[model samples]
Target chain A: MVTNEQRLACAYLLKVGEPPAPALRSFVSEHGVVAAAEAVRSGEVPDSVATETSARRHIDTAAEDLAAAKSVGARLVTPEDEDWPAWPLLPLTNAAARGLKWASPPLGLWVRGSASLEESLQRAVSVVGARAATSYGEHVAAEMGYGLASRGMTVVSGAAYGIDGAAHKGALNANGRTAAVLACGIDRAYPAGHSTLIDRIAAQGLVLTEYPPGTPPARHRFLVRNRIIAALGAGTVVVEAGQRSGARNTAASAAALGRVLMVVPGPVTSAMSMGCHDLLREGLATSVSSVAEIIESVGLFGEDLVTKPDSAARPTDGLDSEALRVHEALEPRVAHAAERIAEASGVPLSRVRALLPALELTGLAERCESGWRRAKEPV
Target chain B: MVTNEQRLACAYLLKVGEPPAPALRSFVSEHGVVAAAEAVRSGEVPDSVATETSARRHIDTAAEDLAAAKSVGARLVTPEDEDWPAWPLLPLTNAAARGLKWASPPLGLWVRGSASLEESLQRAVSVVGARAATSYGEHVAAEMGYGLASRGMTVVSGAAYGIDGAAHKGALNANGRTAAVLACGIDRAYPAGHSTLIDRIAAQGLVLTEYPPGTPPARHRFLVRNRIIAALGAGTVVVEAGQRSGARNTAASAAALGRVLMVVPGPVTSAMSMGCHDLLREGLATSVSSVAEIIESVGLFGEDLVTKPDSAARPTDGLDSEALRVHEALEPRVAHAAERIAEASGVPLSRVRALLPALELTGLAERCESGWRRAKEPV
Candidate 1:
């Protein structure tokens, strides 16, 4: 069990510094959570850490914030916890270490479900798209979510309107695990219309966010929140995104974090799919039309290889060019002499003589009273 | 001018050998057409050449064939003719020279239209697809055909129904040049239902084939004829196709001939687009969503580059992450002091004080009685 002291310190740090706070996170890693929290509160931290915490460090709402979270059945999941999802967020940590400031890992996640965040994320895919998505896009996104969740993978998404809501509902309908990474506080529903949907997600799977209690959802928070959604999933599927949507931002983050980025192709005439086509045209993402393709893309090497779709068989599928020519030369009702057939097919008389018997045996041609004719069906 | 003897020799050669007749084509290219024809007629040729011509070599119907063509207003265009599309057919000749037996150039072309074959094919794109195309496929094909033709490029297609017919009609409606390559005699319309459409194309553009007069269109001939469609254009666009459609055969032939292979994207739910999707997944063809993209794929270097699609602009498009957070922290109607805004936004008090004035200058925030509030719009 996590100590109450550590939990309180994490809660204090989480409330004081807005994530992703690279300077404060590193400070806590070096000086432990409790020491860092105390220093931040006393205004005794370094300039870098002070810059991130100075505005709210004096509030000292750790105990009240913890009570507020508990009132809503949420708890702080920190790195000290067993379900921190270290593996999935490693890419973000590494990217931040490489000086991508915006890719810093979140300080802690406030989760409102009983499922283990680490376990739920082990096989997860993020399904994201525009809030103004078309019906076609919504249908595809929901199908993708249901398919992925039914196969024992978690479907992660933002709990907003349009494609995200559709995906979450599809996952919930499958009785499968899903996690909504939100831009607002754990107790608040940003879109208001999706409050019931968000509540259902919290009861059935997980509703997670980095924001402290009572924080309202803001525009900039959505953009910042997208990185968490991208980090928590093994791969990201962009179903339908406009050229300038939040989903594109998540797609960029997924790519930067070295995750598999898959795009579903839609009709070229749709404005909603333009971003996806642009990514495909630029070779930045793979085109995945079916769930099998998605599995094959993100599954372990050679584990989920997709079987080629069956093509309709044709009667003359394996016929050589010359044999095909002879077959074409045969009339369905009229019998032509071997010499006439040879002349029409432009095959040598000897070759035609040899091929006719072979064709007759294969039931592609029939030896009529006069000479030969095409068989209407194989016998 | 092509001499009478050369035209007759080409006519006889076209009738005697079924293309692609590699040995006979090289023979005519080495010895003159007249000499090759005389040798084949007299049975005094090499075994390889004799193998290709032996069936019909003795039946010299050159004069009769010429008369039959004249009755239909068609004439034989030999390699010796001024209008032969030598430049456009160079790839086939080179492939045949490299010992690809299936890629031999045609002996001669039987032309039914007045346009110069070489001139009409100088800037061309072959638009091909399945005879069982969906309406969506037909619409895209027609749009591509009309768009390319309207830009002064010739549209080439087989005169079959569905996508091919739509493409040809689109080009014709634009009052632009187009060419219909046939599997049978130029005088014979293979898909009889399209006789009127074929006649319109011949009247407005060109109807040309490599087969002699009175020859019927056969299954093997359609496959054989596809090479010419792939060769006549600088690139080939597959609008829509089933897995086993002839359009895919043309796409493969275009790839083999080193022509640009482009595919139009359609809905994944549509079976008609599966072949195009497979090509895209396999990276065997480029995805072209617009006519401009098609031109960019085939046009001379940077000459027909496409402009990037414009995205809708947002007011906060240029704001830095911190500035955006500050903007998000300010409520539209409620004013709060700078200290409260700093705490809400988690920005340091000093930084918040500096950024608020900057936000005010940009009209993103306004000074209220208490402190500041978000401006409804930029002033």
Candidate 2:
């Protein structure tokens, strides 16, 4: 657990370090916060990556930063805090975290809101998309947010223009909780038109940020902040993202972490729905279009009920004759390697290697160390 | 094999009998066409429901219909012919055909086109939907038809107004092969405005129908004709069906027959797209938009590649703690009835019956005479 001083010091480091400085941020995690802070204070390079001069700029200003944060009614949450969203915050884990990507999970979060952070995010779903979403996309996002929020699942977003703005407003209008995980400092956030939206969000649910007071928004910050929006929610839904929208980053994070990733399909001709099509086509996400569908993807009720069978979800149902022939070769008890499984299955070896993972992902084949065991589920 | 006399007789029967007359058709298949024609002539009810006098209506006018069909450059194909679309016409099997509901496989098909009935339909895809389709729906259907046609797959439709017209027109415009599976007889099919369009389809590809040369189009005939559209294609894609459109029957036939079924989703606000959404929600079809996606659902390429996995397809991936507990209680080897499985699974009987099919469809379990057995596909 981090001490109050160490927590405050970590807050100071957040202000000085470049946003999404994975290397330095990782160093703090690797070397204890105090030791890492001491290195920065003593003007010693914390690692080969940090220069002595740059390290000095990271000196502790915890006292000042903490006071500034409190002055605005913000509360600091560290990894050790009870309010921290642990499960969805998986990008912080060593193996899951991506390298120098535009998006990364935050070291600590600053929040201000009436709702309890713990409860607000426990069943949260991130509804995000292009800032310039069309009216159709906005309507979908709003409906999704309202529907999900009304079901008691908080809606999380960047609180940007278009889909995000609509989603936040929907949740607020429904008298349901929502959270805005910002790209800038909670105090320094801008695009002034969203001030009312953000303020309502802070009052109704939460306004969260990784940056300390006075940090300016940058191109990379929003990209980096996308990970937080993804990590804070139980699932991430792209309502109407463009092909290159930052919401795609959140989608990637959600997929990598095995979150329920869904995309609301729109008109195939719309530029706004392109990312959604790409995601659906690539099998990165499944298409969902309503609040009930959104719940089916991320809520607890999904687990308790045995829903109707989805043939699309079972790609195994579509296997070619050869692949299906190969799949039938392995025994449930035997852990057959690729060559043996191929021989047993009467399919060529190259095809088995490729077919096994498809089977594995479809929950058909198990990838033991020996490899290629038929999944014991009934065929 | 259908002798020339028997063929002509069947044509006469098609003109008089209610289309899809599954009972009378099955009688012919069972008793042989000559005997069935003899029975119709003797005015002796061939089966229970065939009243003596009403049965006499099913006489052989094969000679007359054949001459009329030839006059319009049409060729009649029967189940006995090599040109027949056989495999997808599963309703011909004794136990498989459902009682008259919407549509069923045809007793015979009339064809008029340059393309071979066998080859053109080998990779055909039915693109169908609402007659009152929106511009968006029509545009999508057209593009999908054109793209699929360009990829060398035959585009099949009823050639109605809106989506179906657009789909056929798109395929015709691309100079690609297309088939119009009409509800009426080939020579009497067109709805005035679509006459030239129908002519072009007949010239370029095929204008086919189960109705004999002079039968008029009727509501029930269209409903029955939808089964042929479903049966004749490798897959069916509903572009913009209304909630009660005949396209829904094709979708249902496609699903029940275990054919690849896809629906192109449009704006949720569009009532035409509602049927698509309902189909998708009910797991009756996967949502698709483009030719590539359409092909992905129907073509063999999907099985060879390790496409990224779809999370929605794996609803079991999100089992709640209680659900997980219930699932884990069942033994892998046991084939337990619903009540027994419930006892073993520690789930309530009602939930067990509900969950079992979902599990069975997911390939996690198998439904047997005794009850549910653990699926052997593998854990």
Candidate 3:
């Protein structure tokens, strides 16, 4: 029942590590996925096989993975697939790519969710920042995510702590469609603490990755992952970052992808905001203070293709007792020592120290050299 | 038994003003001040006149002031005079007027000090800043003055308070040659508090003014005055300024004159520092942290034109008891309210309020709506 094109397309997706190769994309565009898949299975066309060493290895691995994918309910969504994300391919599909050099061509993405990837990609925007973000940064990023999502745009961001989690939560709180792009496989969340949030995302939006199922997240992979986030969105906004933060990497990727790069400025005295100031001074990025500016900069207004989602009601689930105890001890603008936090939270010093680690891992607190500081600003 | 040439030259100095007109400059360059004055007085050459109304009035006025000047201790110094500020004419004489457009063509400068104007101009650099300056600003300006002057350059400034007075005092304290370009008449120190400082400058270096001996300082004249400050030096540096401070006006003059413009940066949270920050951001001025940067920026390294005087034991003779009292109360980084200052200094509140007016007039203190702050850093 499978056609020659479908077989070739399947082989192409299997050959590439993640996100299918550009040639495969071209193949899917020119011939249907079924015909491409058929060509790959029959070895009917010489061009169907990958020519480069890396591509060949990727293809061989993908072939093995594709065979195993069906058993795990995993499916390869090619550009020809009705469920494929159409929005991310806008750049690849547009005339802008005619004469540009790509730093890295994304293979077709592996995503899990019932929400349409193609529909979400049409209005997706990535808001990224430092993992150890300040309250000022989180507030700005949250506002941006809420505003953009309310305007019918799908909020896209890495599901990491600090600004990223705030951005995702902001969208979810607004009842807007959102996606979390991860470094690890979609099947396994890396941080372990954000499992509940990730599960929520999977229930409502989508969890996407270039890594195959069960692949653990590596530090190096996050850099490569950032490029996909940049390529997938119309623009990237850096909410807060230090001079050497990873958020700057995302901004650089956005620049390379010919996507708009925006940064939020903060008080100059704050060491954390220096990167944004440096970018503004160097004229590499424009300053964005509000979500309206982001939307205007990305030119996402007045588009009828994207539909706005209804707002989500507040979750009835409250913070656990330990979390509540820790939260109650936090004060704005004050750096609390771990011992002090333990004393104020009314928990044993050993237990409080352990809880502090968990709090940091979950993005509720930041570990400074002197002490642990409350990460989130109180609403 | 003054010769016709001498009378004509004296007349030209009186008629055309202390700084010569552009056309008069050309005429003086071609025929010497004496011949140009004769041509003007005799109406033999109307083509060289810059403005008919001004030239005729100047001719009549100069003929009288020339006679009166001879009665006094002052004497006319024409461009041809060995005592004239020869260094300022180097740009014009060398025909490098492209960047020096902001410089007025000096017909001649009147001299009062024992030192030669020509020799001093060869080593001059202007240090200017906000009249309502902060302590940090004054500190920087003073250091620059002393540092640059000690390195064999004459300190040139407007002699107004906060930074300018500090600069002049810094140069004076270092026993280096210094000049004060006044907006008012040289004989009348408009800000009466600086009478002692002006007198010292008149005795040691020179107190020069474009306006006649009795003209009071006018708001409109300062703009033209700033141009002379920009022109007379190899470069100008703004230490601090508010958004629309007159220091910015001086910087514009320096830029127009093609003089090197340098600015010192401060904490961005301070509103007074923002003007300098804006200039640095706009690339209108280079940010300089140390005195060496100023020296190198103006190319003052190679030539040993002006000799450094013995400044090791220079007396702090000019500061009066009242000025010293106000200066002693100023502390770096702390801005105190008038009541607090009065309490701390053991001065009556009424006396403190009264002293603020005098201090502000002398450029020692700046009045804010909240309180009085030190205009310049205390030495």
Candidate 4:
């Protein structure tokens, strides 16, 4: 069980060090959160750990931070919590273990919603793109969000404007769950314009962040926060991103974390889709056209496979080349002798004679008093 | 030398059997054209060969066909001719040798153009698509044709409406060479709407086909004729295609003939681009957005390679995570001691002290008497 002491230690540690704090994370892992928090408070931790926490270690605000979180209806979910999303964050742990320092798992998450973090993220897919997205891109993103959500999959995004906001709204419109991983504190809406949308998401689904309360959203923090968005989702779809959009950073993080990476194709002329096309051209991402395709790409093996789309079959769909040529030779209005049909089709007389009966059986050709002619249907 | 008798014999063989006639091709390859034609006329050939030519063998229109071709400014370019495009058609021969009967090389091409058949196809790229293409598809196709033609490359396509007509027109607009491989006779234009376009292609470029004079365009012949279009070009670009459009057949033939297959990406909502997307999704074709990409895909080894596109670089593009955090913590108007900066950034005081000097050298930070502050530029 997670004791009050452990929760307090986790809340303190969450704010004491900047995220992706590899050395501090290692120390906490080795010493346990309660003991590690005590050591840091007493200035008795290792130099490497001190480097990560020294600046904030002197200020102990565990009790006040917990109170502030409670005031906003946000709870600190630690590794000791029952809903810590351990499985969804496994890739980050694995990647960090493989020596990617930036992929270190979060110390704790500050979440402002009632849904279980782990449960909400069980089948989540991240849909992200440029803030300057085109109308077409926004349309695709919204449709994909709605489709995936209606199919019982949670849509995850950063809760910013443009593509992200549209995706969140789409999920909400379907009355489906979605999680917004913000770059700012859970109590604060960084864009200001999305304050209501953030509230709706928190009420209906989740509004999560790794930043402590009172911590302002910084430029570098968004990049750091993207790792969480990428890790929480089973797959990442770049709906439409400019060549240097932050979504591309999320995509790269997703790929490095071993998450299924997908890209939606748009007009080659659209500058917003340049990053997506580059990813496809480099063979680093799969091309997904619809929600089903996205699911099929990231779903369990053989579980969510999409069927090959059916193309309308033509009347002469399965005819062999020779039979088709013979059928083409037959005239609809004028019935000609087998010799004339053979000459017109460039098929020998004997083969034409043999093929006529077969063609007639298929209702492609018919016999008249004059000779053989085409059926009413065109070739 | 291509003797008149040899030319006449090839003309008779060309009209005597439907193209892709494996048995007749083998007979002509083993026996000289003159002897093979004589044997076919006398009913002394093998049964297989007889099955291919028996119906038309009695017609004997060699002299009249030759006369008709000359009257329409067309010529019988036999295998014995110097400008037979042997290299361009080598893939058809190779594929046929590998047991692909439909890939049989043509015995003779009926040519109705002033350009040398062999020279015009030396560096050719086939740009083909649906007759019912969208405006966007047509625009891209025309641009590709114009770009390729202006670079001294021949743009090859069928003389149908939509993409084909746009491509041919684009090439002609540049006063560059192009070739039209028709399903019908060289003397006739299959789509009456494109008769003027066909005349222009013949006048300035080349109009070639294997079909004899007076042979009308049949549904099956378009498919049979696609093999030649696939062979004559080093690569084929599908600008746009419906799910079951004839362009898909051309794409298949191109792949079967071992030619580089490329498809232009379009909006997924477009039905005209469905076939191209399917090919891309199935990994059967490369996605090319520009003429440069197409050239890069089909160019010779170590030639015509495209460099990676340039993305705008940010000021902190190469900064490590720690440095970025430290930079973000620095204030623009106020300067504080390194300790304060270290605490805000969650970096060790010593590291912040070190990074400050380095950042100043890069003009990203400014040091005042009070401490360190951000430079005027945004992060």
DockQ score of each predicted structure, in the order shown: 0.73, 0.06, 0.01, 0.71
TM-score attained by model 3: 0.51
**Lowest summed lDDT over 10 consecutive residues: which window, candidate 3 chain B?**
B50-59
DockQ for model 3 equals 0.01
TM-score value, chain A, candidate 3: 0.66
Give the TM-score of each candidate. Answer: 0.96, 0.70, 0.51, 0.96
True contacts kept of 1: 0.80
Off by over 4 Å in 4: A301-303, B301-303
Error of 1 at A12 (Å): 2.2
Q: Worst lDDT window (10 residues) for model 2 chain B?
A: B47-56
- Residue-level lDDT of model 4, residues B104-134, one tens digit each, is 9998999998899999999999999999999
Cα error of candidate 4 at position B312, Å: 2.9
When summed lDDT is taken over every stretch of 10 residues in candidate 4 chain B, the lowest stretch is B300-309
Tell me the tens digit of each residue's lDDT in model 2 across B1-379: 6678767766765654555565667677788766776675565645432521242263455777888889999988887788787765664342245554344456678889857788788788888898889999999998988898888888989988888889998898888989898887788856778988888888898999877776666555676678778766788899888776778988887776667898887786777887887787566787675677788888745553334333333344556532443455455777777765554333445666677777777677777777667676453
Q: What is the TM-score of chain B alone in each candidate?
A: 0.96, 0.75, 0.69, 0.96
Tens digits of per-residue lDDT for model 1 on A64-166? 8888999999989989999999998999899999988788898888999999889999999999998999998899888888998998989999998888998
- Indicate the docking level reached by candidate 3: incorrect
Q: Candidate 3 or 4, higher TM-score?
A: 4
Assign candidate 1 its CAPRI class.
medium
TM-score of chain A of 4: 0.97
